[model samples]
Structures are given as structure tokens and as C-alpha cells.
Target chain A: MSSLEELAQRVAEGDLEAFGGIYESLLDPLYRYFYWNLSSREEAEDLTEEAFLRCLLHIGRFDARKASFRSWAFRIAHNLLVDHIRRGKGLRKEELDANREADEPPLGETVEEEAEKRALRQALEELPSSQRQVLVMKYFSGMSNAEVARALGKSEGAVNALRHRALRKLGTILESRGWR
Target chain B: MSGRKSKEIKAALAEDLLRRVESPKAPQRLQVYGLQRILARAAYETRTVERRWFRNPALWRRAVVLPLTALLLLAAGTSGVYAASMDAPPGSALYGCKIFFERARVALTVSRSSDARLEMEFCERRLRELQGLPESGEYRAWERWSREYRRNLEGVDSLLDALPAEESAGLAARFQAQLEEHHALMEGLLKITPAPYLPYLQQASRECMERLQRLRHRHGMEEEERGQPRGPREEEGTTPVGDTGSEVQDGAEESGPCFPSPSYPQAELEDLAPYGEDTAPSGMAWTSDAEDNWGSSPKESNGVMGEGSGHEGKGSANHYWK
Candidate 1:
């Protein structure tokens, strides 16, 4: 079986240190997945912590035969996002713009390149929620199309269509902004 | 608008930009929030088979609820005795409560002036109680009250000494004026005072006089003694000079065994024995409000002969000296 599946089995048996291995493996994907979906970094981090807490609390119930641990974790993060949205806190573009200011340019990236990335972020915020979920899970969460579809409770064709449509919309947006 | 830019946007969306955005992992920032705590709790919880006694309501009632209930009950139970003790006289059961509460008041009072003022009130209270004692068969009660009264005086003395000259002046004048009135009341009591009790009353009166003069000298106030005789013997025409009243001048003031004075009315005698206890109703109490009210308007008190403090309680007491 996979290393994550082995860790999940040990976690079920109360091998405490083995749970750390699973946490380290899944922590980044869950954080980036939430960050791209939410307006603020703090919200992303809180939800990320919440996802892990739920995971550890119910680790004994995980069935590796049915799904990979990463897929299960992504499912939890997605349900939280859905619940967060249902609670009347969807992405607010104004806050998204405010939080985007903290993304300082990396070394060797030109000012023009940074501006292009900034424009891309704004355009990404304008996409529909379902398409953005598929896009964020596919690219940022390291999930295969099948895993992404399973986490979102959609078919593989639906996940693919949502991804392609999101990318095409992003491309059209960049073109409209006179992006090079 | 341009064909080349459109192609670049397409490529960036497909591969170039998504790769860069996917790798934006803030591992350090994530550590600051809560991932480490999750890891630690995961380890700690699974490592120990926690019995989770905190979840038991029975344990919570035993650990928290009972102690709080007991504390609240104790406070409510003692409040009655605490209230009654406020005016308890020297030999009464609640008298100790009076002294204890007075000391606690001084300790709790934050301002030095207010603290000194409180002690001054105690001094006055004790002096009035001492003066109210009967001349006959109350030597033990008299001595007990006299000692406590002197101690209260000493407390006020040190506190006054520590006060600024400006503040001490007004306070000493008021204190002297209050004592002057008490001296006058003592004179009224002296008209009926018997012979054997003369020396103790004389000596006590002399000590009070000395303290008053020291206060006047210290504060630069004019002597306002108003010609009140020092004690029963010294008051003119009340008792004969060469009679038993002469015992004070003959040095019996120091070591005399005082007897009860004659002609004391029974009502006044009971009132004197245990302060204003004779007039106070059984459920009536002295309160901090009396001290506070007297402090705010010391001039309003009708002096030692005035009604004893009327207070807010189930019953009211009106002290009488006539």
C-alpha cells in the first residue's frame, strides 16, 4: 500500500508519531487549497487547522481501501469550504484585493511580471465558485482529476469540464487585460 | 488584442503560471497558526488513554459547586453578627467583633487621611462608651473600656503625628472639640458620681486633658477647653473639695480601687454598662453608614448626650442620656 495509507493504518492503531507523517504530507496541499479559495490567509490557516483536527479526531474511521488519505483530507477541506460559503461568507473581492497586497514579488521576477501575477489573481477571483474549486484542487492540491471529482462529489467529466472552462476563462481574462 | 500575447496567456494558464502558484507554500506562517498544536494534541491524546473525568457532572459538582456554595453561605451567616458587633460594648459578646471590624476598616482604607479619620471616630466611640459606664460595680468593665479607648487614642495619635501640618490642624481642632463636649457630659455625670470612683475618673480625665493639650500644641490651635472640670472631683459644687473627692489630689488617682458611684438612675446605669445597648432593639444594628455619616458632618452629631446612632436595620434604636 502507499506510505500515507500505511501511516493512516498506524494512526488507527494509535501509533502517535505516524500521524505526524500524514500531517506533514497533507498540510501544504490543504493550506494552498484553502488559501486560493478564501479571501484572507488567516481564514485559510484556521480552516486548515480545523480540517486536521477533524482528521485526527476521526482518523480511526478512515478506509484506505475506499480512498487515499490525501483524497479523504481534500474531501474534508472541500466540505468545510462549502459549509463556510453556506454560512454567508463567500469570497469578497474587496477583502481579496486587500489580502493580495501581502504577496511580495519573488527575486528575479520583474515589476511587469509581478503586475501580471496580480492581474491574474484578480481575474481568478471573478470566476464561478464551482470552477474555481475544481481549478484550485486540481493545480494547488496535487489531486488527480479522479480524486478531485471524488472530493467534490462530481463526475470525472464534470471536474475536467470545470477545469478547462476555468482555464479558458482565465486565458480570456488575461487577453482582455492586454496580458503578454 | 495581439495574437502573440493571447498565445502567451494560453501557455501561462496551461503550464507556466499554475506551476508557480501551486508552489506558494508558507510553511513558516502555517507553523505560527496551529498545525504544530494539532500535531502535538494528536500525539498527546493517542499516547494517553485519558479517562476524561472533567466530563463527569458529579465530579464538577464536588470540585466546584460545593465549595462556592459553602463560601456564599458563610458570608450570609456571619453578616448578622458582623452588623450587631458594630456597637457592642466592652464586656458584650459581640464587642470583640466591633474591635476586629474597626481594625479591618483601618487596614482596608487606602487613603491615610480617611484612615486617620476612621481611627479618630473609634477613639470617640470608645470614649463615649467609657464615659457611659456606671460609677459603682463596673470597675472591670470600666477598666476594659478605658484600656481599649486609650489604645484607640494612641492609634489616632500616631496617625495624626504622621499627617501634614495643614491637615492635622483642622482634624485636631475637631477632635478636641468633640472631646471637649465629652468632658462636659462627664461633668454632668459627675453631679451624681459617688466618692470612691473619683481617682480613676480623675486620672482618666487628666490623661484625656493631656492628650487634648498635646493636640492643641502640636496643631497651633487655640486652647478651647471651655472650663469643663477635669473630672467629677474638680467640677465645682458637685462634690466637696476636702471630702472623698480630695482622694484624686492625694495620689489615689494611680492605685485606687474604684467603687460604683451613687445616685445613678437604673436606666442610665444599664446604658452606661454596655454603651447604648439598653435603648437598641434586639434586631437593630450599628453599621458603617453611621461612621460614614458622622465623618461627613461631625458638627451634626448631638454629642455624647445626643441620641445614639440610629441606623438602617430591622429595628431602630434611639439612645437617651437624660
Candidate 2:
């Protein structure tokens, strides 16, 4: 059996040691996923907790044949994040604005050196959720295009097109900001 | 710089930009604390499921039996018996029996009291009826009843046991324990109440009532077939007692006083009725209009609103080169 299947079985059997192992393995990645999407340290922490709480609630319904455990768990986290945004409970508008400003290049030489980085982060925040998600999985998580397509339940070509469009928009934004 | 040299310069800038973005980390305490909370939540859910199974004698029977037996019983047409029995004249003994069975089921499944109590009177009445059953099958029924009764009680006990021993009196914590205990006792009494067994003894005592009724409609006599004490069996496919018409009406009325109705401020609700939606703001923005506009028009509105923004800058150049 695959490692995920074994972990799931142990979980079903109520083996906390195995569960702790799974937690250790996936917690950092899941935390990073939330942090990238939320872009706030505090909200990312809360959303990550909420995601794992949901995972605990519905773990019994997971099916290994349909998706790997990581994909399924991540999908739950993604849906929870969407729900959290819908509920208007996570990172306030003010915080998002502040983060965007913080990401900009500083006023002097440091500003010039980091101007592109700041521009990229700002551009990423402004993209639609669909494009943002594709960019996040592909670029931030180092997922391959095919893996991203699978995770997002989109066609590979659709993901590629989204990636391409996201890149073009980022470049345009940077150009407008005189980063290029 | 030459065109190629400028292109190389842009690529390096993008690479440097992308590399500078940092991934945030959750506090170490939050990670450990969240994991503990998750484990606790999982344990609570498991206990809830176990409590529900033990509280429901019918479900308990099903859980104990092989899956094939359940499928065969379902296919054999005994499912309709519960439904037909439930339709017996209101206030009649059989009807009362149906109501008690339903209450036990609801007491296990639902957390709402206004919902739980609607059928509770019928259950209490049926409990009266069970006390009148002859002593012949009394022992067998009591044994069957005790096993489940004890199991459910123990399940509740285990849940309380698992809780940190120090939180014995906080309202939220105490309320859950009380609810579990109340439900367990009600379920236990429903099983051994001894009243509904009268119908069973009546069937058994009157040998001439029909060897024919017994044979032709054997599926209808499920408790007899299993040599289980006769009591109210749920009518198969019948609306659960909680969903009965009168119960719904009562629920609508009781809903106003028992809990704060979502329709608080009746005038506001009526005013919102014309909108063909619940008036209460669920706190979510109506995003359909925005989504529709976004989907149809791919133009850059301003800033980086488009699908791919900023990627074509230094980062895109670097990625392309790499």
C-alpha cells in the first residue's frame, strides 16, 4: 500500500502516533499554502488551524482511489479558505493593503534592488483567485503544471494559459511601475 | 546595453525579485495547539457516533448483524412494516409505540429539544404500554434491552471520562454531559419499558389469532421472527416521527419561543419576503454580479486585476530563460 493509504488506515484505526507522523509531514506545507494565499502571518495561522480542524471532522470520507491523501487534504484546506473568505472572517481589508505596501521597494538603494520583488508580490495579490491559485501552486509550492491542474481540477491547458496570462499581467504591472 | 544584454539583465532582476518573496511560518505553539485540538475534536466525533449507535437499539442490531442480513431484510419487504405501523390511528397503542420509537431515534440523532420533545409524549405513553406486557417474553426482552441500555450509558460515561476531570461544572461542558446522560436513559427505558410487549404476548397467547397471519405476513412480525420481544418497530420508509405533519406544525410554532428564530423582528422578515430571499444578512457579499462581469471581460481594469499580472516583468523573463 502507498504511504498515504497506510497513514489513512492508521488514522481510521485511531492510532494517534501515526496521525502525529502525518501531522508532522504535512503541517509545514499546509501552513505555507495558507500563508501564501492569505499573505498575513496571524490570519494564516488561524486559517491553517481551521483547515486541520475540518480535516479531522471529515477524514473518514476520504477515498484513496479518487485522489492522494495530500491532494484531498489540500483540497479541503482550499475549500475552507474559500469559505473563510466568504464568511469575511480572515485577514481584514486593511491588513491586505498594509501587506501590499510593505512589499514595495524601500526609498533608496534597497528600494531599487528589491523593486522587482515588491512589484511581483503586489501584482500577485491583485490577480483573481483562480489565477492566484494557479500561480501559487506552480511557482510557490514548486508543483509541476500537471500536479497543479490536478489539484485545482482544471485542464492542464487551462492551467498553462492561466500561468501564461498571469505572467504577462505581472510583467505589465512591473513595466508600469518602471521595474523593468 | 545590447538587446540581448538588456534581456539578460531583466531576467536576472526577475529571478532576484522572485527569490526575495518569503514564506510565512505559523507560531510553534499554534501548530502544536491546533494539532491537539484536532485530535480532541476527532475523539469527540467518534464518541458521538458511538453514542448514537448504542442509543438506537435498531441501529445497534443492524451494526451487530452481518451486512448481508441487513440487505436481505431490506429486500425482503419488511421495510414497509415500520411505515405502515406508524400510520396507525393517532393515540392508538401502535401509534403511541411508533412515536416512542421515533423519539428514541431523534433523541439519538438530533440535538434540538423542541424537535426532541414533539414525539416525547408519545414515547412516554408507549413506555406506559410496555409495562403491561405478559411475563413470558419479559426476560428475553429485558436482556436484549439491558445490553444496549448499558452500552449507550457506558458510551456516555466514556465520553465524560475522556474529558479532563477538572471541568466538571462549566455550563457548556456540563450541558453536553447532561444531554448525553438524558438521552442514554431515555433510550434505555424505551428498550425495556415492557408495555409494548403486550401486543407481542397477545399475539403469542392467542394461538388461534392466526398461524395464517404469522405465515402469510411473517415479514411483518420481525420482532417475533428474531424471537426478540415485541415492541414498536419503526415503520419502514415512514417519515421519521420527528417529521410528522403535526410535529412540523408544532415545530413551526415552538420554533418562535424555544430558540431565537432566524426570523427575529417579524416586520423585517416580511419586508424582505418580496425579495424572494431570507432577509437576514448571512454576511457574504453577493458576488454573482462581479463574477459574471469578470468572466466575460478579460480586460485589465487597473493595477493587476487581470489573470496574469506582473509575471512578464523580470520574473517571467528569468523563468523563461531558466
Candidate 3:
């Protein structure tokens, strides 16, 4: 919400009430971003908290003109994700399987549709982490190229090129699996 | 790939798939509650720090040190007993006065977690001081220092026990690691300690190590984390001597006469600012200049204490000091 920008200003002034408003707006998208990447609900939640805390502490450093509060917030979450991966704290395979089952389509899907969706999910998962992140932000989270670029610290042009390449690869994987 | 048919189909499919992938909403109660807790904690820490500063005796002393020195000397008939005891070594009469002063300090500290960590830091300094002591003669000094070491070790164990198991895990692991480092150094010192005083040093180290081993076991931490050996006796020649002094190197050198190193590093502090500026929105630029501790009132038994409480409150203080 546009109120997030105003909330950021208040948060910079040490208003925890304003921080609560910002948290409500961003928690879901940020949690979803991490969940899509890490495939672990608990870890995503933990990382979400860590990112928000860092944001609350360093809110003064944020310049709204440089990036939207959403993008700035995502940058914090992205850095945390990088650190988590660097530390080799990824989930085990069994945990991944359990999470995947829960993540399956909940209702009214034909078996064929669910299978196709699973195949597409696998294809996306097979992409490199950076590309996967771009796709998740662009597709699932619905962030625009400029926004994803800001969040990922890449140029807008770079994000567009990455998106094009990622979409081609996904198409290739779908065709290969005969899921198209 | 850019053909009209392919483009249309790809766009439609991408839209459908992305839309269909369900993104679960964050759990409202847990998510909101967690943020509330963090916000409440940050606000609470900011308030305590401000209160501590207003009520801080050391701050008051600095405001009129020269005038107070003259007035105290005129009134007390003897040099200020508490101020003079600041430099007392472990066994001296002044040292008891020093502990009494610390009782007030520990009482005023807002965070129980911080107090536990401070006690651990003291145990480390006492161990390093014990190692630095002469091997021959001065048995009285050695005994006194060893007694203080045991007392501080007890403080660490008891304070750690008082904290919730989850909250104390990181500090406890770090304390265990540093204790093992000293345990290694004590092994080296055992051969050289005066034969008469050797048993006292041995007993002090044994009790300290046994307590540390139990702490580690209780937390399910591995001894090999700091390269300490498992079970009671550490293998000779295995423990690294570097770590013993390494943990003691926070800006202790600059603290000079009065201030000792802080109990923990900025990173070890859970509820407070990292080091420099308060988390308060006072409109000051945030700088990473954590070269010194927060400059809180120095720990009571300074000067004669070990190297100093380095900025790395936990073993990670290894970063700034090393």
C-alpha cells in the first residue's frame, strides 16, 4: 500500500506502530518469496522476521526515491536468503517432499492439470537460484521488471533479459516433458 | 520463438500457471505477534539505556571528577574507598569491596541475559590472569586469583541456569568454548605452577572444566566446535593456546585505568543496538564504527583483570580483535 511509504518515514522516526503497518503490508509477499525459494515454511517465516528487524533498525538508510519500500524490503530479504544459502542451511530432501505435498493444488483440479503444474514447478525449480528468484518475483509475486531489478540489484534491462531467457527455458522444459 | 502463435500460447499459459500457483497468506497471529515482540523489545531496550545513563554513577562522576575528587577527599578522611578498590586484585581486602560494588551493578543492569554474559566474561579474565601469574612464589596471590576464578565460574553457571534454555544457548556455547581454551592453557600451566600451589590451580581448573563440559552436554553442543576434546580430560598438546588470549583482546588496552571491556560484543546483544548509536530514531546517521564497546560504566574489577573484554562478546568477538 502507498501507506507503506508514510509508515517507513514514521518507522525511521522510531515509531513501532508505523512498523506494524509496514509489517502487515509486506509480510505475505516477503514470506511467499522466501517460501517459493526455500520450500520451507518455518525458514521462510524466520527469514521474514529477520529481514523486517533489519529494516526496522536501518530504516534511516532507506531513501524512498532510490527504491520503493517494497523493493528496499525485498533487498533485505534477498540478502538474508543469500546468507542462509551461503551457510548451507538448506532443507533436507524429505522435508522438501513433505512441503511439496502440502503445496499441491488444494481443490477442483483435474489430475492432468495438477501433473502439468507439478512438471512446471519442477522445471522452475531446476533453474539457477538467481533466475528462479527473478521468475518468482516477476511471475508469482507480480513485481515489475524495474522492481525486481531494484530488489535484486540488477538493471531493468538485465531483469528483462533474464526473464526472457527464463521463460524460454521453461518452455523448453515443458516441451521436453510433453506437458505442453 | 517469436512467432505470433507461440507468443500467444506462451503468454496465456504463463498467466494461467502463475495465477494458479497458490501463495499462502502468512499466519496472521504468529506473524503479527512476532513483529510486535521485536518492536516491543527494541523500544524497551531504548528506554532502559536512556534510564541507565540518567542514573549511571560513572556518568555522574565524569561530570565533576576533579571537583568530586577534592570534595570526597575532604569529606571521607581517606581516598574514596570504592574508587580506590577499582584496581584491586582478586585476594586483596579491596577486592571484597569490589564485589560489593558489582552487586549493585548487577542489580541495576536491565537485561538478565546481559548479566549472565558479563559473568562469563569475568571468568575468562580471571583465568587469563591466573595463567599470566608467576609459577614460583606468590602462592597467596595465586590462591586468591584461583578463588575468584571459581567464584566467577559459579556466577556464569548459575546465571546461565536462570535464563531460558533457548535464550542462553548461544552465550553458553561461547562460554564453553572459551572455558575449553583456558582449560587447555591450564594444562600447560600445571607443569610449571609451583608444586605447593599446583593442586589449587588443578582443582580450580578441574571444577571449571567439569562444569563447562556439563553445560555443553546440556545444550547438545559439540566440544570439537572450539576443537576441545570430548569428556573430562583434554588430550595434551591438542588445545590451541591462541584462543585463550584471543578471546580476551577487546579494546582492553585503551580502557586504561578504569573502564574494562564490555561483557558481550554488539553482536551478542539481543535486545540492544549493535554498538554505536541507539536503535532510537534520534536522527543520527548510523555508522558501523564499533571499534569500542558501548562505553557503559566499566566493570568494577578493571586494570589488573585480563587482556580486556574484546568487542566480540561471544567467541565471534574473534572478528574485531583478531
Which has the greatest TM-score? 3
Q: Which parts of model 2 are misplaced by more than 4 Å?
A: A90-92, A98-119, B1-16, B48-322
Q: Write the per-residue lDDT of candidate 3 for residues B91-193, one digit (tens) a residue.
A: 5678677667666667788987888877777777676567557432343555567667777788778888888867777888888788777777776665555
Per lDDT, the best of the predicted structures is 3
Model 1 segments beyond 4 Å from truth? Answer: A1-180, B1-64, B135-140, B190-203, B216-322
Model 1 chain A lowest lDDT segment of ten: A98-107
Residues A1-180 of candidate 2 have per-residue lDDT tens digits of: 238667877776776667776676667767877766775666777777777766666767878788777777777777878887788765465777687566433345455445544456666677788887777676666567776776788888999888766665555556667875
Model 1: per-residue Cα lDDT over B163-273, one tens digit each: 886777778777767656555555555554432232334445545544654553443323224443345333332222212332222222223222223332222222222
DockQ of every candidate structure:
0.18, 0.16, 0.17
lDDT score of residue A44 within candidate 3: 81
lDDT by residue (tens digit), candidate 1, A47-83: 8888998798788888988887888888888999899
Candidate 3 segments whose C-alpha is farther than 4 A from its true place: A91-94, A102-117, B1-12, B29-32, B41-322
Evaluated at residue B147, the lDDT of candidate 3 is 65
* Each prediction's whole-model lDDT (CA): 0.63, 0.49, 0.64
Give the C-alpha interface root-mean-square deviation per candidate. Answer: 3.6, 3.9, 3.1
